[model samples]
Target: MNGKFIAIEGLEGAGKTNAIKQVGKILQEQGVHKIVFTREPGGTPLAEALRTLVKYGIDDEVITHEAELLMLYAARVQVLENVIKPAVTQGAWVVTDRYDLSSQAYQGGGRGIDSGLLNTLRDTILGNFYPDLTLYMDVAPSIGLKRVRSRTSGELDRIEVEPLAFFERIRSRYQILAEKDDRIITLDASQELSEVTSALRVQLIKWLKNKGY
Candidate 1:
């Protein structure tokens, strides 16, 4: 694809929605007006259905770990094929809230699934496709959950109600992945909103310039 693809990744309550806004603002200021905003598991109609099933299964219908993992990728490829690939192919920047990294953290780390198997599934579905840049918003689970509680008024989705240990593992995996990938940068989401935005803006501007955008 000719256009850049940037993925914003983090655990729940990491302010990814706001981060996407900052990304849009940064690109707009750089004279890049054609941009598409998307999130994993819900960017298209079918994907949205999968998203609902993943987040909230119908009345006690158990969502097994295997099913959750598969559904996530299923929705992901749908969005990638119908939305992300086309947007980037048409020279429009794509800004996504989450992608494969999430599955790695949530399923592989948090749920104790093996990374090797997840890798196989990822390769089978996505092949060599990946975002050019991924910004991981790092925050302590306790602090993040507090923010989440305030925002959601203590109401949480199924996954959001997972134990604190789940998020800890997810964050640990995120840190490891960020350390290994040059294209992924870890941002401290615990900072004030303005500071977080400034840091994100600077990182994106530098990366975009490096890419000759």
Candidate 2:
């Protein structure tokens, strides 16, 4: 893999949609223009169908935890086989809105799934495959929910509608992972937009230089 995979991960309303653009600009300056951007759950046709099934709260039947976990991995595998891996093989950079870490935070930490089981599933699906750089945007759950509410007049998605406590647990897991992993950098996303953009550019540039890009 000459091309790099950069994943931007965080809870809902953590400004990930905009953060990708910043990362893209920094990558362009580093002469990486063959960039492909992908979002979790909907990067391909089959993945989009699974995303709808996993995200929309339809017919009021609770989606079992086991079902949710399987669907997420199913969508992710589709993206990898159909989109991410192919692009990376062709020497194109990939920036993603979310990736494997979401499951670690949501299913494992938030839903209280056994970490051992999660790791087993992850290894089965992904093995050693992972991002070259991962930016975990850290935002307070209260602030994140408020941002989501103010931006939307309609109902929230199934996971996005989870209570504050749920997101708090997810955030805690993200913090722990970012602190422990050198590749995962935690960014304070509660700052002003310009400040956040500048911070992302600076951090990404530093990492790129360190990698001999």
Candidate 3:
């Protein structure tokens, strides 16, 4: 693709929404006008339906780890083929709220799924497709959950309702993956909102400069 692809990743309540807005502002300042924003598991009609199923599940029916992971990939492939690919092919920068890495951390680490199985699924389903850059907002599980609780009083989704230990594991996995990958930037999201945004702006700008944006 001629255009760039950026993916934002984080645990729940890591201020990704604000980070995305900051990214947009920075890109605009850098004279990037053709920007397309998307979210994983819900970027298209079919994908949205699958997102709902994966998030809420059927009434009183248990969703196995494997089933959940498969549902995510189904939704993901739909977004990839229908929305992201077309946008990027047309030279529009594609910014996504989440992507394949979410599954690696949440399913592989939190759900205790096998890494080999996860890697195989990713390789088979997505092949070499991946974000040009990934911004991982790092936050402590307790603090992140506190933010979530403060922001919304409604019922939590399936993944959001996961225990603290689960999130801790996911965070650990994210750190591990980010450390190993040059494309992924681990941002400290435990700071205040303003501080987090400031840090994000600096990192994004640095990356943009490196890419000759």
Q: Please report, in order, the local distance difference test score of every candidate based on alpha carbons.
A: 0.92, 0.91, 0.93
Model 1 Cα lDDT, one tens digit per residue, 73-101: 99999999999999999999999989999
TM-score of the candidate numbered 3?
0.98
By lDDT rank, best first, the candidates go 3, 1, 2
Error of 3 at 9 (Å): 0.2
TM-score, cand. 1 vs. native: 0.97
Residues 76-130 of candidate 3: C-alpha lDDT, one tens digit per residue:
9999989998898999999999999999999998999999999999999889999
Q: In model 1, what is the error at residue 84, expressed in angstroms? A: 0.5
Q: Looking at candidate 3, what is the lDDT of residue 33?
A: 91
Model 2: per-residue Cα lDDT over 57-131, one tens digit each? 479999998889989999999998899999999999999999999999999889998899889988999889899
State, as a TM-score between 0 and 1, how close model 2 is to the true structure: 0.97
Worst 10 residues of 3 by lDDT: 151-160
Name model 2 segments beyond 4 Å from true: none
RMSD of each: 1.0, 1.0, 0.9
